[model samples]
Target: MRQRTGRLLGPLLVLLLVGAGPDGSGETVSLDGDRPGERLDVTLTRVVDPAGRADSERLVAVELRLENTGSVPYEDSPAPAAHLLDTAGQRFTGTAAATGAGPSLPDTVTLAPGDSASGFVTFRVPAGAGLAAVQFALDAGLGDDVGHWSLS
Candidate 1:
């Protein structure tokens, strides 16, 4: 009976950990991409509001780390599409104009198996807006698999 309990406990712990989605800030999420056998492990490393202010809109930079954990190579020439949602349910798309906030992600990245990359995706939000979450997807937001990270 002790052996049986130990066997069941292992899988149960795994499920509990994996079932907990990336709802907490700084948690890593594993999601499949558009292609078969393609998986990406993503983590929201940090979010920052730079000190400089050149416009009325605020620039929120989200730093992310992406790793190719599957067998196939992951390639996104223009980088993945990312969206920032506010507490009021308003959504904002990623903007290149916000690159001034910090070091931006490369326009293109190709990662082989076990490769990883880290960069920032910036969004232009209202000065008073409260951020809620961020959504990232491959294939320019057309992919079925979208990974979400809660910011609140």
Candidate 2:
């Protein structure tokens, strides 16, 4: 199976080493369409909303939705980690310039072949910090497949 690697927003890409966990399940997305003669389809959906928490801090509200759109059932991949980056090459969390949690959101969820779940990532930004963009990617390092790599 070809390894899947992607960048978050950009640069903040999610690096998932192969055999990340239990042998990966489910089929790979051809990016073209569903396999021939197959009646089952799986889809991963995500929504990212950045909101201000404090005067100098901000948080991005991310909602991940997984659904088995087809008539069949199969194990789904884990979602990736979401991160935020600034202009000066600094992680969003509390560093020298910025002061807050980068993209270490608390997400412990897994959806069944037909079930759906949601999670959130809290980003703490310091006052007067220059933020360029937010990134998202599946850090297979987390030992899961729901990296939810769509909102990029």
Best by TM-score: 1
Tens digits of per-residue lDDT for model 2, 58-113: 55433333343334432322223444455566654211121132232223434344
Tens digits of per-residue lDDT for model 1, 1-152? 00000112434622222222333446676767768888887777777765235488777888878899989998873234778889999988875454654677777778999999888887778888887887777666555566666665
**Runs in model 1 lying further than 4 Å from the true structure:** 1-23, 50-54, 77-80, 96-101
lDDT of 1 at 73: 94
Number of the top lDDT candidate: 1
Would you estimate the TM-scores of all the predictions? 0.76, 0.38
Can you tell me which runs of candidate 2 are displaced by over 4 Å? 1-50, 54-56, 66-80, 93-106, 139-152
Model 2 weakest 10-residue run by lDDT = 30-39
